[model samples]
Target: MIAWFRQHGRALAAAVAKVRAQPMTSALSALVIGIALALPAGGYALLSNLSGIAQRTSIEPQLSLFMSTEAKAAETEALGKRLRADPRLAAVRFVPRNEALAALRRTGALAEVFAALEHNPLPDAFVLRPRDAAPDALDALAGEYRRLPGIAHAQIDSDWARRLAALIRLARSGIFLLGALLGIGLVAVTFNTIRMQILTQREEIEVAKLLGATDGFIRRPFFYLGVVQGLAGSVVALSIVSLSLAVLDRAVQSLAATYDASFQLSHLAPADAAAVAALAGFLGWLGACLSVSIYLRQIEPS
Candidate 1:
């Protein structure tokens, strides 16, 4: 046990010392990994916030059911009562023509224009809130409303929100593809870095082999070295991602406030952050293993 501990401890110390010796090279390699990782992390963060907005918009999706010009107040009231009684609907609010006109007048720019109109141009409308807010379900509900009595037209106010949700989903798939490609690049970079280190220590490796040192003994330090490099790179990547999110969150809050929306940007979940760090370290370790396997075989005590 003591011998095993001493040997492993020496390998770990050697690996750390080697990194300390070449801080610039180590940092630059880590920076490269960091940039590659940050692209996906940052994109995922943005997508998460957008998804939240989409969900809120979906849950409260409002359908505007406009009554026909000739529709009477009794028919409008009956339609409202009918919609309110539906099992699938959460709530329904009836907006009379006069109220609609009043709202138009409240808009500063359109107030004078609305005041000059001879007759109220707007028809009575019902603002609908559905119990189920799924896009397909909402569309189906809208279609049913259009066929109802006195409903001249039915339009969902959250159509843009549905589209936004779809776009965010598509963007997430694209980000995954891009992340896969970048992960390969990360592996390649680590592989080459390990290969170069192996070549530089060729003489020392040959001497160790001649002294009857096993392959595992020679490989330990390089393995440790790769892990260290990967961890350093992940630290840099996390820092960049965190800082970017901090800045973006502030900007998003300010923008949301302008529209009187209670929106806030979200950060990566704990599991996701851990996954990022784990993936980085795994890639580095795997790259080192591959390089060492190929190159170490070529330097056999010659």
Candidate 2:
């Protein structure tokens, strides 16, 4: 076991030496991979932030149950209790007629219009937040509520939620497609890079083969080199994403301030960042393996 580890350590050392040997080439290759990765990563981060903002800004499907003018207080009270007991509802709040009128008056533009009213024209209502936000679920709940004894009308403003949900779904699909394409590009980049390295060390590999070096021995250093490149690329990608988010957050904060709102772009979570790095490293290793397998066969000592 110790010998295995020692062999790998030596291979890793050689890989590092190769990377350091051509600093400019390594940096440029990393930069290309980083930029490619950042495109999808940035989109994912933006989508996440938008989804959070939607949640914070009341995107959940809501139903308003307005009482009939003739609905007795007792009947209204019973209906409220029933609604509160329903498992489908996340929350239920009863708004009295007078309280609703008072709220209308609180709105600056509507204040004068409401003040001229002889009596409260608004009906007592129950504002409901449904646990399920699916369009069908919302529609079913609205239908059920409208059938209740005291419910004069069941009005739901779930169109926005539906639209937002659809938009998010589409955006997520787009990001997934984009990421897939970029991932293929990333692999190609690594493949070509490893191919070049193999070409550069063709004579060395041939000599190693003639000296009775096993294929595994010949492959180890190149494998490690690919992993190193991938890891470096991931680091560059993370840095690009972080710096971009920082700049975007500054602009977003400024815009939000105009609306008296507070919002900031969030960076990729630690787990997500780690996953990116791992995936990058794996792609690199795969590319190197492919290059070595194909090219090394062609380099047998004559």
Candidate 3:
């Protein structure tokens, strides 16, 4: 392992030096990779932060139970009893039609309609909350509760929760797709770069093959070259992403402050950042390897 490290270290240094010799080309290529990578990387980071924000945001599990106009008072109370007695349910409240009528009267905007009605058409209903916080379980329970006797309907109280979860899922899929495209682009960039390098060093590969060097040995330096390029690009990409997130976090904090919200901005954790860098490095190595292997096969030693 020590010998291998020494060998790789020497190869990495040579690759870095070679890249430095062509500053303009290196800059342009790295920038291309960085920009391509940044979009999806930043998107995933934003989603990560937003998900954390969602968890921190409090949501009251309010279930609305609507009754049919044919429903009577004793039945509503009995329904509330069954829901409240269930182990899965955390809370329940009965909303009588009289109380609902009073509430509308207090609003004043509906006073004329309330006064014109010969009889209250509103049915008595119960509001129920599930003890468990899982949205799927909540939905299932709502479905079951609606099928219960004398209960006309049961539904989630907040449309926002459902909508937000859907939005997150959509964003996640989009980010995944975007990341895949970018990865392919990275490989293309690395492949083209290695191809150019191969052309420049054609004589060296021919001479090495004639000297009895195995394809594996001949491929080592180029693989290292690719790894270096990838590692450098990853560093640059991650830096851009982190800086962008920092700016976004500050903006969010400022906006939250304007609304007097207690919400805080989230930073990308260490493990995630490391994973991003490692992924970039692997992609770079793979891209380089593909190009070198294909070209090496075609080179005829004269």
Winning model by TM-score: 1
Question: TM-score for each prediction?
Answer: 0.80, 0.76, 0.72
Residue pairs clashing, model 2: none
CA lDDT of each prediction against the hidden true structure: 0.85, 0.88, 0.81
Q: What is the TM-score of candidate 1?
A: 0.80
> Which segments of model 1 are wrong by more than 4 Å?
59-63, 81-123, 127-149, 300-302
RMSD of 3: 6.7
209-288 in candidate 3: lDDT tens per residue?
A: 88997787677778877877777787788888988988887888888776556555555678977877787778888998
Per-residue alpha-carbon lDDT of candidate 1 for residues 164-254, written as tens digits (9 for 90 to 100): 9779989999999988988888888888888888888888988888889888898888888888888888788888888999998888888
lDDT of 2 by residue, 1-302 (tens): 99999999999999999999999999999998888888888888888888886676666678999999889999999998899999999999999999999988886666888999898888899999999887788889999889989789998876776678779889999999998898888888888998998889888888888889889999999999988888898999999989999999999999988755678899999998998899889988988888888887777556
lDDT of 3 at 224: 77
